[model samples]
Structure formats: structure tokens, C-alpha cells
Target: MGGTWMQVLGLNWLVLSVTGSAATMGVVVMLQSLPVLLLGSWGGALADRLPAKPMLIAFQVLRALLAVVLLAGDSTWLIYAVALLSGVVGSFEGPVLGRFGSALVPKESLGSALALGSVLSSAGRIGGMALGGILVGITGPSALFAINAVSYLAVIGALSLMRTAEMRYLPTAAPADRGVAAGLRYVRSQPVVLIVLALSFVLGSLGRNYQVSMAAMVSGPLPAAPRRTASSPRSSP
Candidate 1:
């Protein structure tokens, strides 16, 4: 997650530095998150079927490659393509991470584990952003990106070091209970689920993304477009 936050900052910085268009930044963000709307359920189901550790390692390697791809070129189309591809891969990888997490702890520790994971993730995001901001002054976005790529490999190393034999494997979803149709059916039966989904849709699509707004503010009345937009609210974690 630290690496992820670093890349997030670097990517937004890259977009702002190159194009200086908030709308384009918004498009890049949309491309990254759209896959979850399109393929989340399928990815969740697939995560249940795959071997957790191996798949997780593979996903990390792929993410590292994606970060490297950002460094390989600065073309607008290439950035868009990488953003879309990263989103697609992440839609699958995110679920696999959840599945892998379940294997590492017993049922009794599940709640504690999840809470800790969330806390650590938030901490990582905050620290990573602060560190990235400082590093941007020293090394620029390319170095941040390269460091992010290396961070993925560090995660791979940590995953490789885990003690697999002690992990408590959770049972996979039964065949009849898996798939998009089954997931849809379950969601339809739960009103609370529907409400949550509706709220998530509203919040995720409307409230969360502020790239264009920040860009406009920074470039307009603010008059510090480049530096501000690069580290502005829109780009912040």
C-alpha cells in the first residue's frame, strides 16, 4: 500500500506535469477505477478459485511491470493505456489480496487482522504521500515511479518469506455458489447490500474524484498551476 500510494502520487504528478489538464487527470483516474465497476464480481469469484500465494505473487510482479511501463514512455496514449491496464489488473488483484489475507489468520483473528490491515494501509498512504512529496523535490516523478516499481518487488520478497504451512486455509466458494449470477442473486436479496452499493456508487463516482476541481482552482485564481497542481488537493492521497 505504501508503494501503491507512491505510484498514485507519481502518476497524478506525471499527468499534471505533462498535460496540465485536470480533465485528463480525471480520465486517467476513471480508467483506473472503471474496471472494478465492470469486473469486480467476476474478479472476486475468481479469487476464490485461485491459489492465494502464487496468484498474489504473480499480481505483484505484474503491478511492478505496470509501474515500469510508466517509466518507459511519456506519451499521452501510453499513460492512458497503462492506467486502463493497471485498473484491469487491480480489479482482480484486489480480491486476491483479500482472499490471501483470510488464509494467514484464523477466524478468531479475522476481525483484528482486517482492522490492522486497514490501519496500516491508511498509515502507508499518508506516509507515502508525504515522503513522495519530499522526494518529488529531489528526484522527480520518474524516480518516484521507479521506486514504486521496486516497492512491488519488496512486497514480493515479503510474500515469499511468509510461512505458508502455518496459514489456515479458508474453504473456497462451492461451485454452485460461485459466479456473477450467484453474486447478483445474493445482492438482490439483501436490501442493506443494495443501499450500500447505491451509496458507494454515489460517493465513488461523485465525491471521491476532485482532480479537475483542484486543477481549476490551482491554475485559475490560485495562479500557481504547475507546482500546486502537482501537489494539490486533487493529487493528494
Candidate 2:
């Protein structure tokens, strides 16, 4: 999810740079999440019915294009629109990624494979966040968006190198007889799944929500600007 992290950092920074308001930043983040709230299970079902590799690649490319659109936009509204559109692509991609793990490895090896994926995701997030900060500091938010656009090529390269003939995927089934409402019913039937979803919502609201404040902090005069002993001109007073 390096691309996701970079996208988040770039969007927050771009919004803050345009509006200079934490409230606006928070609204942008909230709008980005609205699609997930609205389209959760259809996304999951779509993932289950599709070939994982192509879906994953297409979403990443779309995400990169959305980032490029944001980079080119001059208006905060366009940036927020791109954020929402990118989120729509990501909402579908997230479930496919989870399902793809099972297809990539045997049942016996699933735990280790998942652990490895989690570790790599964590590392990618760290790198993306750090790189986003450096690029935003050095060049600007638009450049960070452009860099994020380019980063998706790495995933495309990795996918191209994989031997898909050796991989395994379940046969695509017809759409579930149940509708989206049924999907919710199915989820509610599982207490653990419901609990996890609830916890995710809580964490997203409180913990992950700090991107708004981070946007506010980084958008204007750098936080360290006043303390730049090495670069400041002589005091006039």
C-alpha cells in the first residue's frame, strides 16, 4: 500500500496548500471515505468474481492517473474530486488484495504469506510517508503526486514478472443470488466480522483521521522555519 500512503499524504498536503484550513482537509478525507461506506460489499463481490491480477493492475493504473489529475489541477475542488475518485478505485482494490492472498498461496501457507504481506505493507507505508514528506518539503505537493503516479509502475513490473500460469484462482461464479442488502445481512450474521468492521470505523475516525491536522501543519511556513540556525539571515533588530 505504498501507493495508498503516498496518495493520502499528497492529497492532504494538496488540500491544505489550496485551502489552508484543517476543516477543509478533514472534509476532503471524509469525502474520500464516502465511497467505501457506500459501496463496500459490491466491491468485495466484484473482487470475488474477477481475475485478481488484471483487476489489481487496472485499479493501480487508475489510481495513478487520478493522482496525475490532482497534480495538474489548480482548484481545491478538483483535488477533492480526484481524492474521492481515487478512493472509489481503492475501495474495490482493497478487497481484491485480501482475496488475492488466498489465491497466491496454499491454505497451509496462508498465514505466513499474510504476515509477509503485512510486513511489506508496513514498510511501504513508512517509505511512502517519509518520501512524501521529503518531496513535499523539497519540491511541492504536486511533485509528490507525480512521484506517486510513477510508483505504481513498480507494482505493474512486479505483476508482469510473475508467472500467472503457475498461479491458482477459483473459477469465477455467477453473481451471488443475494443483493447488496443480503451482503450486509451475511456480514451481520458473523459477529467477529461485524466487530472488526466496527473497530475499523473507530480507528479510521480517530487514529487515521489525523491526516487533516498533518495537512494543516505542513501546508504553510515550515514548522522548523523559525529555528533554522543554519539558513536564516541576520536579525534586523
Candidate 3:
């Protein structure tokens, strides 16, 4: 969550600096989210079948590599490509992490675990944004990208140290019960779950794209003349 928030802050600043156009930044943000919006259900289905830990490790590695790519390139097209890839990996990673979290506690303690998870996620977001904003203002977005890449290593390392035997593993669904369609059917059978998911989808799609708004505000109202170079300085504008 920290790495994700850092990337969000750094990416928004970087996009504004590079294009100096809020419209282009909006398009980039959309490209980043498009994959997740389209394939999130498929990703959840995959989570139902795959082992979450290995899948999470793989996704984290991919995200770290994508960050490295962003750090290494200056092309707008390449940035868009990295964003797309990150979204693809993130779509799966989100659900896998949720399921993994559920498995970390007994059924009776699940509510507490989820509540704690929410608190931690909120804290991580706040810390990441604060630190990322400061770091980007000082060192630049590339440095934040590098730091985020290293953060992934910390997560991978921690996951590596976890004992699988101690985890409360959820049983894999039968073959007939697996896949996107099956998941949809299950959701449809549960009215409360279906309603919640529908509301979440609406909220996430329409109301939750803070990066787009942030980029527009920075580029529009908070304009600061950046260094006249292909690589723009990562400072507030």
C-alpha cells in the first residue's frame, strides 16, 4: 500500500511535469486504470484458483520492474506502457492480497483482522503520500520510483519469511466452481454481496480517481515553470 501510494503521488507529479497538459495526464491516468476496470473480475477468478503468496510475489516483482522501467525512460509512450502493465498486474494483486489477508486469521477473528487491515492501509496511504510528496519535491520522481522499487523488495522478503503451514489456507474451489462465470453466479446468489459490489464499482469508477484531479490542479492552478528539458524536475508546479 505504501509503494502504491508513493507511485501514485510520484506518477501524478511526473505526468504533469512531462506533458504540462492536464488532458494528457488524464488520458495517462485512464490508461493506467483501464485494465483494472475491465479485467478485475477475471483477476478475482484467478485469485480463486492460484496460490495467493506466489501470485503476490510475482505481481510485486512485475510492479517493481515496471517502476524501474519508468525510472529508465523519458518517453511518454513508454510511461503509458508501464502504467498499463502496472494496472494489469495490480488488478490481480489487489484481490490476491485481500484473500491472503482473510487467510491470515481464524473465522471468528476475521472481522478484527479486516478492521486492522483497513487501518493499516489508511495509515500507509497517508505516510506514503506525505513522504512521496516531500521526496519528489526534494530529489525528484525517479528517486521515488527507485524507492518504491526497493519497497517491493521489502514486501517480497517479508512474504518469503512467512511460514505457509501457519496460514489458514482457504480450500480451492472445485474445477466446476472456478472461473469468472462461477464467481459472478456466486455473487448474484448473494444479494448483499452483489449490491455492495455494484456500489463499490460505481464509486471506484466515478469518484475515486484522485490522481487525475491532482494532476489537473497542479498543472492548472499551481503552475511552476519547470526546467526547460525533456526530463522535467519533480517539484510542485
Task: Tell me the TM-score of each prediction against the true structure.
Answer: 0.90, 0.83, 0.90
On lDDT, the stronger of 1 and 3 is 1
Q: Please give the lDDT score at residue 50 for candidate 1.
A: 75
Prediction-by-prediction clash tally: 0, 0, 1
lDDT of 3 at 33: 81
RMSD of each: 4.3, 6.2, 3.2
User: Best to worst by lDDT, what's the order?
Assistant: 1, 3, 2
lDDT of 1 by residue, 1-237 (tens): 877888887877777776767788888888998997799888999987877788889888988988899888667787898889989988998888888888888899999999999899999999988898788767878888888899887899999999888899677678988888988999999999999999998987788766557666766688755553443323331
What residue pairs are clashing in model 1? none
Per-residue C-alpha lDDT of model 3 across residues 53-137, encoded as one tens digit per residue: 8888898899889988888865678778887887788788888998998888999999998899899999999999999988888
What does the lDDT read for residue 100 in candidate 1? 82
Candidates sorted on TM-score, descending: 3, 1, 2
List ranges where model 2 is wrong by over 4 Å.
171-179, 216-237
- What are the lDDT figures for the candidates, one per model? 0.82, 0.72, 0.81
